[model samples]
Each structure stands twice: as C-alpha cells, then as structure tokens.
Target: MLRSFTKYLFAPALALAATATTLVVAAAPADAAVVSVRVKGSLAARTGAANWFGKTRTIKNKQKVTVTCRVSGQYLRGNVRKTAQWDRTLIGDYISHAYVSGNPKLPVCAPPAPAPVAAVPMGPTGTMTNEQFLAAAIGPAQQSQRDTKVPASVTLAQAILESGWGRSSLSANDNNFFGMKCFNNAPGSYAAGCKSYSTQECTAQGACTTTVATFRTYRGSVDSFRDHGANLKSLSRYAAAFNYTNNPNQFIAEVHKGGYATDPQYTTKVVNLMAKYNLYQYDLKV
Candidate 1:
C-alpha cells in the first residue's frame, strides 16, 4: 500500500519540481527590461505550450520578435519532442525558446490580443496559358515520375497549381517550382536552404490568408521535383500516401491527408490540371 502511494506521488512531485524550477528562473526582477529575441531559424509559433497545438503562425529567421512571457513547452530537439522552456510573443503564441538566442531577459506580458483570422481570396489569378506552364515543367515531371513512383501528372499538376503556372517569383528565380520547405526532411541534394516569398494559404475551413515565408530554394526546378518525391517517400506521415501508385486521385488525396498543401481545393485543382492537360499519358510512358 505504501509503495503504491509513493509511486503515484512520484510523477506529480517531479512535475511540480520541474514547474517550480521553471517559474523561479522565469520570475523577472522588478526592474528587468523586456526585449526581443532573434530567431536562429524559421520557427513555428503554436497556439499553446505544446507541439500538438496548432501552429498559429511562423516567425522568420533572424527576425526579432518581442517576447512577452515564458512557459515550459514541448519542442523537437532533433527528432524527439522534449519538455523545455518556451517564449511567448506579443501575438500570444508560444515558440520553443531553443529556437531563439542572444536576447535579454523578458517580463510577463499583459493578456495579448486574440490573433485575428486571415482572409481568403476566391477565384482566378494571372493569365499565363496552361500549355506554356506545362511545356516548362513536363521534362522534370517525367523524370520524377520515373524515379519516384509519383505520377508525372500529379507532379506537373502540383507544380502548376503551387507555382501559378511557373509565374510565381519562387519558381521564376529560385527554381522552387513546388514551394517545398527547407525545414522538411528533403534529400540534401535538393534541400539547399529557405527562400522568403509572399504567398497565400487557406484554413481547413477555407479562409485564405496571405503571408510571406521562406521555403526551400533550389538551383533549378528539377531539384524541386526531386525533393517533392523525397518528401513523400522519406516522411513517415506521407508513407501511406506514397504507396498509392499510378492512381493520381488516390495519391494526391493521401498526400493531402498528410497536409502536403493548404489550399482547400488542392487535390481538386491537381485533378483538374491533370485532366485538362492529358498529363496521365506521360505516367503511362514514363
């Protein structure tokens, strides 16, 4: 009976000790000056103090964001998420403190304003002909189709949709036709680093918001194609999606389930692009 009681108390006692240690360290002096912390890399600011929380937004590399408070949270130290200290921002989101360095101590913040919902844009953009875009991307798509089990149609379609028919600046300059991220487990051959570009995203509820962010930049579009394949193959979350070969709809739907892209109509758009372009025929040949 005594052993059972001691075992039950052990966990709570450890938790309390951890919390007390954190609270003591974070308690600011009365004259402490508040300051901003520069992000060492792109950081996801979560809705709460846990990695499981929704990423409320992102902070850019080397950008200084004002820290309002500190709390203990879970952060990925390499592949493992561990209990560690976190810093809250003026936006009321929590970022793992490990992502920031070279900053002064901070003060507890006032209750922050609720994060505002972002707007969505509905309908068409640009006047680039589909043939023009298809012509540019088909070469890499065919090669990718052969190499990865991903259909050329799906690859081409995702490129067309994400890159605005190769008109988006990330495609034009960075050769990042697919908007892949540097933070992902991309093969080193393709994962050079990140590039900042203004882009749009949609919530699951279909509300769209425009924001600028850094993504994996590449020497050419082929790298983007290859990395897209790598992402599907290497990431465990995408394994189920990668297995549905030759079926574009099932393949895209599975990737979508793994949260490949944010546009509410992503799979629909890819399917439409494939249909409109006879892109599936290449899959048969390649």
Candidate 2:
C-alpha cells in the first residue's frame, strides 16, 4: 500500500515539470522577435521614458518596427507630455519636415493638448490690422492686470526676432520657430551669426546646443503660437513666468528678468508693442 501511494504522487510531479518546460519553449520565439527603435524628438513635456513616443517593441504576432518620440529643448527636456500613439506611417503627421524626412519609416505622433487655459475674457477686441504681420510677430498677453511671469512673452518676442515674423527658412519650411537643434538626432544647419546654447550651459541637454537649435514648422501661425504656449506651460522651471500668467505685459517683463531675452530693451519693446496694439486683449479670451 505504501509503494502504490508513492507512485501516484510521482506521476503528478512529473506531469507538472513537463508542462512547465513546454510553456518556456513556446514563449522563447517571442523574445527573439522583439526589436525596439528609439526616435528622439519632443512630443510633450511629461514624456521622458524610452517607450513613450511609439508603440511597444514587443509587436503583436507579426508587427514591424516600433517608434518612440523624445522631445527636448534648452529649458525644456524629455518626451512630450500626454502624446497619443499612432501607427508608424502616421508618425510624420506631427513632426517638422526636417525631422520627419530624416527617417521615412518613423511615424510622427502628437501629444494631446491640454484643456484651453483661460486668460481673461475680452469682448470683441476687433480684427487684426497691421502690415508685415506685426500683430502676428507680437504675441498675446493676459487680459487683466493681475497675471504674473514674463518667460512666455519674452520667449515669444525672441522667437519673433529670431524667425523674423515667422518667415525664416527654419520657421517657414520646418515649422521650427525656436531654431532649436536636432541635437545628435539629425544633421542640422543654421543661419549665419545664429547662437547655440552649449550642452553644459543649457538646462535641457539631450544633445541640444544653443547654436541654431532645430525648430518645427507648422501648418499655420495658430499651430506655432499654440505650441509655443504649450511648451512654456509644460515646464516647472517657468513657473515664475506663468505666475504672471494673468498679466501679459508683466509676464513679458518677468521673462526678460528671467533671462529669456538677452536684449537690454527687450522688456521695453514687448511692452510698447503690447500697449500700442492692445495685444494684451488676446489674453482676455485665451
């Protein structure tokens, strides 16, 4: 009776071992099939992980390459925050021309924009009417006197100067309004006399240098304006700039002091423009 009991227990144990071995072999093929491709570019502020830009490398059954986005800037770094994933073919839909064409296979993806942040309410400020796209060059400001920070305004002004009313080759062709660099991701160029921030000196140094940083050209001016604002809103370091978020002019002044614009008259120019054209009114409804 004791020998019979021992045989029954041994049979179950052997069967369990065989089952485990079979499962391991079946899963082995998947490990070899998985391959990952890392594509660097800004998709949002919160995205920094290796796999955020594209789909997972462990493709389902028979999928091809997986793409990921890594978007960074001098003051801003990491993958774009809150990006929506897309197939590899649609990847170029979000990236600038210069970056998208670099790899035809890489898909472009865009981050979901946050809910519209209200500035102040303005009642029909009237239509824009300036030659040379002057209003376009000058950005919007807070609608009231209570807002704080200047980084966004200051950065906008600088971008205006750098891109020459959004007409620069980088801006017009690539939608790169900031002149940010492609870092090590691609071979990029610059206009003569353009300055680039050094990796050691810049705050976000994922291959970003001050010298003619890469920029993304957009479908329209609205896209550029929106992206510029989103970029500022994403970072914590620019909190001081956002604190004055209610006051567009104050925000411009704050940004100048924040070291956004190097020009000594940066504040004066932005303030003058704001008051002259009532650009601050845009903030009211924004």
Top TM-score prediction, candidate number: 1
Candidate 1 residue lDDT tens string, 50-107: 7789988766666667666677667434211234767777777887654343333655
* Tens-place lDDT digits, model 2, residues 1-286: 9999866744554453231110000112332322243333222211222233442222222222233433321221112212222223223212211212122232223565899986522211112333444544444322112122333344445455556555666665554455444434442322212333332223322243344343343444444444455545554655576677667677766655665545567678767755665554444433
Which regions of candidate 1 fall more than 4 Å away from where they truly are?
Answer: 1-129, 184-188
Candidate models: Cα lDDT each: 0.68, 0.40
Error of 2 at 120 (Å): 21
* Cα RMSD to the true fold for all candidates: 21.8, 21.1
Candidate 2 lands at a TM-score of 0.36
